[model samples]
Target: MLKRVLLLLLSLMLITTLLVGCGGGTTEPETPEETPEATQPEAEETAAIKMAMVTDVGGVNDQSFNQSAWEGHQKARNELGVEVNYVESNQDADYLPNLEQLYDAGYDLIWGIGFMMGDVILEAAEQNPDQKYAIIDNAYGDTPSNLVGVLFKAEEASFLVGYIAGKMTETGKVGFVGGMDFPVIHGFHYGFMAGVKHANPDVEVLVQYAGDFNDAAIGKAIAIQMYQSGADIVFHAAGGTGDGVIEAAREQGKYAIGVDRDQNDLAPDNVITSAMKRVDNAIFNIAEELKAGNFPGGGTVVYGLEDGGVGIAPTSDKHVPADILEETRAIEQQIIRGEIFVPDNEADYNANY
Candidate 1:
């Protein structure tokens, strides 16, 4: 009976040791831990709309209309998330090739920045048939479905400054330096002359053409002769060549009139004021329209005094008299109101005269 009792006690002790070894000694559970959230990837940015601008032989940095147009496109690129590119034309022959290459690169829009580019852009537009184009300083006939012509009434604006020149001239003489005798440049000459005559009918207006828009040396030489011949102020429509006209004015201690955009800052002492054609505004308008999916197309859109497309640049450091400034404003109003019929060409000038 004692041996059977001892065997029962030993079996109970062994079962207790097995239960402790199997983790039944403590009746407590282990504390649980929280898992962290998984990180998510970021989304990508949308692609930008691409556009290209082809500059005429005047080059993109002409510091005239070309530069203004480029600035407008560049603004669209920087502020509105559009892609813009420009190719310069070193020679007249380069227009076609430069435009064709950009078109082939699948640009959503293209621009040609001079009147001289009219034929080439028209040809390219005809060939592409589907691509959109905005042209500056040119109005085309038989318009394309995808093309818009940006034209400015530069003559009317030039006339306003021409009147200023006539009123301010100490010599009773003024001069005009033109890049070419083309209709556009000719219009500048005629309108300016008419304004001078209107202000001082006895004031003599001398005119010369540089025959090339890119030659500053020629423009300078022409301006020197005009100054020597008794002209006190010289107005230039000679693109990059006009830079020389400004230089000549500085050397002669005379004043100059600038074209295309406000150029009073070009030579503050020499440039009285500039005839602004709002090229920058025009280009920006087109770019904004395109980016907004409004293609502003077909036929020509003429920008004039009434449209805020043309005006005389504010006098900068030139200290234009208050009377002259007021008179300029009045003349602008006259042109807008049809009281002053500024002629655009020789025929118009003849008829009006």
Candidate 2:
């Protein structure tokens, strides 16, 4: 009877254990199965640097200085993996606002595309001491620590084209159209005059200033008048206004020389050659230097024939004779070797001539 009682008590304990295992008590959620930590994604790459430019009144499509500079910025973006952009200035009044727009966006570097913006760029640099700035065609007497001046020997390039004009003119009379009476224009005019005289002392060069760089009509009118007056070739340093000069040449069946860029495409048959001021190279090199952590600021970088900064366009071979091109190259070497000194101003031009 005691053994039976013991068996019955053991069976009752087993039944209670079975009931507890089946779900008679609260669940503890299985400790959430020891969940693993979440994985993270990789970080993205950023641009090496950011650069922006404020174009002059000529705008980026001027097919001249502004256009060339924009090309440089594009090349920097493509080749160096840098961020690049530009804002056009429709008029002189737009320069400040355009620069301010780029400044507010916090660009690593800012560029003023013309000498006309010298005063304003300098003022902006002084106001924002930490920001970097650069300008083309202008240099300050005392540069700020954050500013760089990129100057080209326009006279050198102008002289080469002027020599072409003098040598190629069938009427023995070539013409010059200037944007303004400013020093930069003076460089173009005086250098051209010197080159013309150097090439052919007897060839007459008529001069006119549109007093505007954006007026194609004014340039066309001036060029037409000059063409009618017996000039067979015309060279212009009048920015976008030079486009009209080339147009007039096409219409009148005369020759035109472009400035700041290779403008042969503008009037393939009419445009004989161009004066190339390597604004694109200047801009690209500066961006490259900045990317390499060697920003050259607080100084002026002068680009000349020796450094391949300024010269006649490569398309000269298409129109100019091989002998002429050879002679031009010889003269180029003379200038580079310091055997020939091209005058850039009125007084020097007059004194030397």
lDDT of each: 0.88, 0.92
Q: Give lDDT: candidate 1, residue 116.
A: 91
TM-scores of the candidates are: 0.86, 0.87
- Per-residue alpha-carbon lDDT of model 2 for 62-94, expressed as tens digits? 999999999999999999987999999988899
- Write down the TM-score for model 2: 0.87
The true-versus-predicted C-alpha distance at residue 233 of model 1, in Å, is: 0.4
Mark the 10 consecutive residues where model 1 has the least summed lDDT: 313-322
After superposing candidate 1 on the true structure, give the runs of residues whose Cα lies further than 4 Å from its correct spot.
1-46
Backbone clash count, each prediction separately: 0, 0
Error of 1 at 285 (Å): 0.5
